[model samples]
Target: MTATLPFTPPLALASLSGEADADWARAGAEYAGAAFLGGIALDADSRAAARELVDRDRTEFLPDDPLAFIDRELEALAETPIQPAFNVRSATVDPVVDAARVCRDREAYLEINAHCRQDELCAVGCGETLLRDGERLARYVDRAAATGATVGVKVRAEVPGVDLPDLARGLESAGADFVHVDAMDSESVIADVVDATDLFVIANNGVRGGETVREYVDYGADAVSVGRPSDNPVVLERVRDAVARQLGLEASG
Candidate 1:
């Protein structure tokens, strides 16, 4: 059966630090029907200094290789009851390796990072730049699928020359399991892309509450991912109700 879209809060596990233990996962899973693990940032230089900073601030799971760190974290979460999914930051480097690791472990899903707009990341030809190179982006999707993992590519809409509908169709045709659109402050952009693609859609970016999520769902999305919003249970609770109502599921509250 196709996985039902999460109804409760839909735990959007904020990048690694956002979820430190099973309690966080359990809480999110209980409140949100699904959980999304925050992203693992990868740099071309594998900058030790940057990696150190991430380690100091993000999580204790940090490793010399950020990709390896992500692999280890997914392994650790394998025993948990909460369904797990991972997001990669600027997934231009060795995405296949990362997807292979996840596939080896049989994790729930793997998301590509095409939405991050960090200056440092963009400068390195990662993040949204991947979209500019449709050939490479399509190859990445093909590689991810070759790993036998459910692959989804997350992208920011509103980038110059980056047509959301066209990109979504490209990703879908390249074997992506889903096309994650970062709608951030653009409802029209979201609606346009949603209307254009038949692929599973995960709407994110600037989603503040149930009202905002409802708006996106109304536009056409299979599910909406909540990140910063998940930090506040009250807000997540509100979103949960909205998602439930939209999906015709019983509200937990």
Candidate 2:
């Protein structure tokens, strides 16, 4: 039998700069009811640096690996109340090896990123470029799923010549656990496309207020992924409360 999953909101940590005193646990608690951590950017140098950073605390840290570092940090934060989700960089075309390693070690539900529009990332044939080649994307999903990890894919919607429904169906067929649709700042267009997809829909696009989240959820999204807005408090208590209330209402009636 499939394990039951929580209906709490999934908060995404966008582009963290690794400040000296970043309190991830507190950050998680403040935003969503549960914590889904981000900021695991990997390149050859950065990956090595991160591994070394965790190694210093051998007793507290599990090992010099992606999953261990993430797990250790979460544990140290004592934020057991929230579930952990990770956002990592996919620097190569075939991200399966790294993706599987993370899933195995971190024990996380993997999210294959194909939505980042960064120039450097794009030049490397990562992110949204991955979408252009459906077969490769499918392979990555297949690889991640083979590790017994729940796999999700994030992609941009407005790419030229890219058919959203077709891509969604392909990803579904490739065995993705979820399809993260980047709505950017547009909601209506996203809602329309999301309604057409067969996979579990994670609507992400400037989702700030609860009302907008409600519209996405009501429109048939399985869940909503929100980012930290510059002006809003780090812990978006209002949004969290609103999501919880809406979920509760839905469950009851």
Candidate 3:
């Protein structure tokens, strides 16, 4: 059976900065269906890349032991009503597998980042580089799935020559449970991806009010996630109410 999210309005808070920890998630728990923590760097190469991101004035989660960090963070959210998920970046497959095992034990979620377009991370083959290498990403998803954790991939839109829908299909075959799409400016692509695979689709980018939420819902997105402004109570309240209304509209139709 395909895995499902219990989000009533199907909205989530996207991981921002490696600083988006358990505390940040808890603060937004009442407004979110799930909370993604970290674009945590795992393994040596990805760690170095994360340091570079830090050098560029970006905050990253650079724990001495990433697996232990995952365990502790998920444990912190064990009592929170929101589903706790980790968004990880790794150049090697082993760290991803190990992290998935930790999430499995905690019954949290694991999201592979195929979304970050940072040149430093891409140079190490950790982020957007995976979008260009479908075979490797499928391998990562397949291996992570074997760990029995709920797995999803965060992908961006408008990458030159990359077909998002096709990629979603391959991920589904590889056992991914969901696809988190940062729909840059191509909001309609969510429909293509939804039609292309059974993986639950979470449409992201500029989701603050009824118009944006309704657009994604019209495009068939199963859920929507808030990014930079996820902590804004005004925005979250608007999105929450809009999504609930959309769900009601769908139910009545």
Task: Give each model a TM-score.
Answer: 0.81, 0.73, 0.96
Model 3 Cα lDDT, one tens digit per residue, 48-143: 988998999988998899999989998999898788899999999999999999988888889999989899999999889998899999999999
lDDT of each: 0.64, 0.57, 0.89
- lDDT order of candidates, top first: 3, 1, 2
CA error at residue 180 for candidate 3, angstroms:
0.2
For candidate 2, what is the TM-score? 0.73
Best by lDDT: 3
Model 2 clash pairs are 30-235
Query: Which parts of model 2 are misplaced by more than 4 Å?
Result: 1-6, 9-22, 30-36, 39-79, 93-95, 230-235, 249-253
Residue-level lDDT for 222 in candidate 1:
72
In model 3, where is the ten-residue run with the lowest total lDDT? 1-10
Compose the digit string of candidate 2's lDDT tens values, residues 30-105: 5543334444545554344344545654111113465555555544544344444445555543444565555555
lDDT of 3: 0.89
Q: Which candidate leads in TM-score?
A: 3
Candidate 1 runs further than 4 Å off:
1-24, 42-62, 90-95
